[model samples]
Target: MRFIINILCCILAFSSCTEIKKYHSIHAGPKPIAVVIERNPGIRVTGSETPLSVLYENGTLIYSEQSEADIPFYMKKELEPEDFKILKNEICMTEKFKKLRNSYNLCPNILGSTTVEIYMSDGKNSKAVSVYGYGIELEKIHDRIPYPDKNDKLPDEFRRIFRKLTGLNFIEAEKWTPDYIEIMIWPYGNAPEKSANWPSGWPSLSHPLTRKRGDSYSLYMPGLEKNDLNDFLDNLKPKQAVLINGDKWSVDCRFVFPGEPLWMKAFNKMQ
Candidate 1:
C-alpha cells in the first residue's frame, strides 16, 4: 500500500509541474499561417454567400475561404487593361499577421501552380466567378540585391517599423532578403492603404501608383489596396506614429540607426 501511495504522489507532482509550464509552450499549438483574400474594389463586385474552397499542389483541401462581395459605388465603365489600368495580380493576405513565422508551409510548393478561386457577384444583376492564379515560383520576396546605399548592406528601416507596427522584430536586414522578411505597413489608420516589403517595384506600366527609383530599386505603393492597409494600422494603436520605410514627403530612414524600441521579447521567442 505504501508503494502505491508513493507512486501516486510522484504522478501528481508531475502533473502539477506540467500545468505550471503550459504558458511557456504557448507557441506549440497550431502554429499555422493563413492565406487571406479580399474582394477587389476595382471590380465593383461582391463575393458569394458560400465559402470558397482552397486546393493545394494538385487537389487537396487546404482551407475554406469565403468573402463578401464589395463593389465600388461609382459606375465602372467597360475598360480594357490599358484604358483604366489596375493591378489584377495582387495578394490580399500576407504572413506578417500570424504567430508562426514559417509561411512557406502553407504557400505554394517548390515549383508548382497554386490556384486561388473566388465566386463574386455584383448583388444587383451581374453575378460571375473568377479564379485567380497563384504559383509558388512567382511572387517570391526572397530575392536579394545590394542595398542602394554604397555600403552594400541591408536596410534596418523595416526592422524598426516592425517593432513599431506589430511589436515584432526580425533578424537584421543584412541577414534577411527582401523576400524572406514579410512586412505590412500603413501610412494612416482606417484608410484604404497599406504596403508590403516587396523587393521589386510594383509592376509599372500596369500599376500607375508605382514608381521606379533606379535600375535596381523600385517603389510600389499606389497599386496596393488602401482600405486593407488602413484597417490593419487602425487595430494597432500602440504603433501609431511608426512609419515603415518612410514616405515621399519625408526622408527614408533606411540608412539611419535604430529608430524604434526593438521588441526583444519576440526576437527571443522566435530564436
Candidate 2:
C-alpha cells in the first residue's frame, strides 16, 4: 500500500507540471498600451547634441549608462528574427528569470510617450518649456562619421523588422547638415558585433556619441512622415485643452520648426 501511495504522488506531480506549462503558454504575449501625444511645440533649434534623461511614469529610470545593463528593455528594434530565439536559449541555459519569459513580452505601450523639456538660457531669458514628445517606435541608430553622407540612414532589413514587430513605420530621414553629429545604433542583444555596419555604445553611454534615444533621433533627421510627426505631438499632452475658457497658453516659438509641419497635419487629422 505504501508503494502504491508513492506512485499516486508522482502522477499528481507530473500532472501539475503539465497544467502549469499549459497555463503559461496561454498567457504568453505582449501587452499593448494606448499612447497619445497631447501637445508639442517648436523651439529655438540648436545643433548641439546632448543625451537627455527619460523618466517613466513610476519614475523608475529604465536605462543605464552601460551597454548591456537592460538589454531586453532597450533593443526592441535591434533584435533580428533568429536573435530572439537565441535570447530564449540563453535564458533557458542561465535559468535567470526564466519564468519571466512567460510573464512579459516587449510591447509598444511599455514605453509611453516621452515629453522633452528643454531648459534653454540664451544668457538673457531663462525658460523651461516643452520641445517635443517622442513617440514610441523602433529607431535605427546611425554613425556620426557619415552624417549627411550615409547612403541609408536605416537599412531596409532593419526597417522591415521594426515594422513587423511594432506595427509602426520606421521612417528614415534624409541627410542634412546638422552640428555635432552623433550616431548610435543597436544590434540583436544576443547577437552583438555582427557587422561593422552598426554603431558602438547603443542605448546608453558616457557622451552624446554613445547615446541613442529611441526614435527621438528621427526628429533631427530631414525627411518627415505624417504619422511620425503626429505621434510625436500627441505625446506632449499639451495644456491647450480649451480655447474659449480664456486659457491662453503662450507658445514657445513664433514659427513652427521644420518638422512641425508634418506633425501639425497629424494633429489636425485627429481633430
Candidate 3:
C-alpha cells in the first residue's frame, strides 16, 4: 500500500512534466530500456490492447497478455543477469537504430493496419521509431527511400533487436498489477437481455470520465485496486455488455502508468 502511495506522489509531483521525467517517475523501479507497441488505437478485447511489452534496465519485464479471456491482465518476469546482459549488449552494438530518425511514416489515419512503435532509452537519451503497416506484407510504393525516414518493412537491425527482446526466456511469470487500470465505457445499443449489472463500487458510468490518448475514451479507475477490479468483473466476459444508469454500455479496459496521461494526450494530438 505504501508503495502505491509513493507511485501516486511521484505522479502528482511530476504531473504535466516532460515525457522523460514522467516516464521514469518510479524512482526505485528500473527504467525501461526498450518498449514495443503494436498500436491500433482502436477498441480492443479486454486483454489484447496495444503497448505489447516493456523491458527494464534491471531485467524486469512487464507486459499485457491473455489467452481467450476477458478482463485483461499484466505479467511480470525478472530476467537473469546474463540474459539481460546479452540483450543489452546487442542493443548497444546495433548502430543503425541510433542513426535512423526518430519516427517513420506513422500512418495514423489508415485504419485496420497495425503500426509498430519502438522506444529505446539508455537513461540519458531515448529514441522512438514508428513503422507503418508493420507485420503486413507491404511492397515499397517507391524504390527510393523517402525523406523523414519511411521504410516498407521492419529494418533488419531493428527486427533483430525486436525479436530478441520480445522472445522472453522465461515462461513462468506471476501476474503483475500496475498502479491503475484504465477503463473506457460507452452505452451499448444492442445489449443482450442478460448482462452483468455494473459493479456497485466501481466508478459511475453516467458521470463523464475523461477520454484518453488514443482514438477512444479511457479513464484510470482511480484508487481501484487489482483485487477489487478482478472481483468486480470476475463474472464478465470479453465483449460482455454492461448495464449502468439504466442504459447499456460496453466496457474496454487497459493498464496505465501513473503519468501515462501526459504521453497519451500527446498521442491523441499527434498524426
Which candidate comes out best when scored by TM-score? 3
Q: How many backbone clashes does candidate 3 have?
A: 2
Q: What is the lDDT of candidate 2?
A: 0.27
Candidate 3 regions exceeding 4 Å error are 1-30, 41-48, 64-74, 92-94, 105-111, 136-151, 187-196, 205-248, 257-270
For candidate 3, the 10 contiguous residues with the lowest summed lDDT are 136-145
* Candidate 3 backbone collisions, by pair: 188-248, 213-264
Error of 1 at 118 (Å): 4.2
Off by over 4 Å in 2: 1-9, 21-156, 164-271
TM values, all candidates:
0.18, 0.17, 0.61
TM-score of 1: 0.18
- Model 1, residue 69: C-alpha shift (Å): 21
Model 2 is weakest, by summed lDDT over 10 consecutive residues, at 249-258
Q: Write the per-residue lDDT of candidate 3 for residues 74-110, one digit (tens) a residue.
A: 6788878997788777774357888865455544445
lDDT of 1 by residue, 23-47 (tens): 2232122111112222232321122
Can you write out model 2's per-residue Cα lDDT over 129-200, one digit (the tens) per residue?
221212222233223223333222333322232223234211231222212122222222233222222123
